[model samples]
Target: MNYAIAYVVYNPTVEQIERINEISFGHPVYVYDNSETISELPYNKDIVLVRNGRNDGIAVGLNILLETASGDGRSHIITMDQDSLIDDHFIKKLISLAGVDDREIIVAPMHHTGDITYDKDLVGKSSQKLYVLTTMTSGNLLNVQFAIDVGKFEEKYFIDYVDHEFCLRANRKGYKVVISKDLKMEHSLGHSEQKFSLLSLEFVPTFHAPVRRIYMTRNRSDVWRKYFAIYPRWVLRDFMRFNKELLGIVVFEDNKLIKVYSIVAGFYLFIMNRWGKAELRYLVNGAKK
Candidate 1:
């Protein structure tokens, strides 16, 4: 199977992309830049850069990478984010776990932040378990043929639920989502981890920026509406997890009021069928006149 590396970079520096240089050997790489100002990459790399010239969101970038690479006769894509770092061994391990029948269309490495966690020693074992609810985009081997049949990604999702929505679609289509049992990767969630305690129990909430909160809330609403009938138990558990995060936000995070209001705005936007990038307000930013 011919494979290629597809990355979505936004406001990336050379140092960020430099991490992938080693593992990206032998396979072609498609870099979809969503930065307002594209940064120049180092010379002497087998990279094809496609600048979207604006922040079109992750889904759009992945869609472009998949289609562009598919046109180049690539059968599979190992999706990645500019910030996530993995070695050549990581890619080999993930691709080795693909189902013999190719029904496991989305094969991913296990991250601590995923639905389950494990010890470090389990970092390369493939389990027969399949069809997981979700997996992070980075370190995933997406079958290009399956993705094409699903009409690519849901670009209107912009960012959040892009991978999960696709995973759900794949499951519905008789394809499976597989994960390696012991292959561990440090995939982070939120801006940073915020730890707190309530009712004598400690909790850690994934703290996201206000803008991301809007996407999460809006797309999460859409996911529940669309998939609740098919995934009621998963929806209920996800609902509880979300509310718990909100409780942690109210108790421990900074900018709680603004983030909470962003959630409300996100829900309203969903009601209006508003999809794509959205701004909470013209708050302070790093813009220069």
Candidate 2:
């Protein structure tokens, strides 16, 4: 299957530009950059930038990249985030994973959030063959037609839980979503705190900003409602993890009042069947911050 490299960026920085440059391949790198102001990204032959001067959402940018690449006759696309760093070896592994039994799969690397330091004893589990219920958007070598068949992205999500919803839908249809146990990628989840470093792996708590907490809570609730019956293990595990983060915010993090309120507003919106682009300036009670 023919493959292409693509990533989406918003308000990219110099370091991010350098990171994107590191992933360049034989093909022209496709970029869906929705930087708020027109960015200073190069308009060279090696890069194809799709700067529409809007922050519609991550989902819109990703779908545009996927459709554009597929329309250009590519069989697979390795969608990545601008902040993610990769090398020749990582690209080769993704290419190889795409050739692993053509039975519709979205192969992703083991995401190592930049903050946690894994112990040496955790090395052998790299080959554990992890077939997860969902994987993140970054570090994925997604099959083009398979994604389109799964009904493209759920644009209503806009940002959070988009990948989870897509992966769950595909999993229900007997399609595979495998995270590469051997390959590791430098990915940032949130403000991470090392929880533990043993038990064959590690755990890190991601403390997101209050605004992000709202999107995550809302989208998580929406996706949970959509797929809880088909994937209770995933739903239950993730719910506990989310509550853990919430508890952390209440006890440790700042902006306690607003963050907790954001979660409540998010859940309230979900119950009220309201969706798309969350209002960022006020609470559910119409009080401005």
lDDT of each: 0.75, 0.74
**Candidate 2: minimum summed lDDT over ten consecutive residues — where?**
116-125
Per-residue C-alpha lDDT of model 2 across residues 110-163, encoded as one tens digit per residue:
777653233311212235446666778887999888888888888887788998
For all predicted structures, in order, the TM-scores are 0.89, 0.86
Model 1, range 109-167, lDDT digits (tens) per residue? 77766333433212223355444766678989888988888778899989998887887
- Steric clash count of candidate 1: 3
* Positional deviation of residue 93's Cα in model 2 after best superposition, in angstroms: 1.5
RMSDs, each prediction?
A: 4.0, 4.7
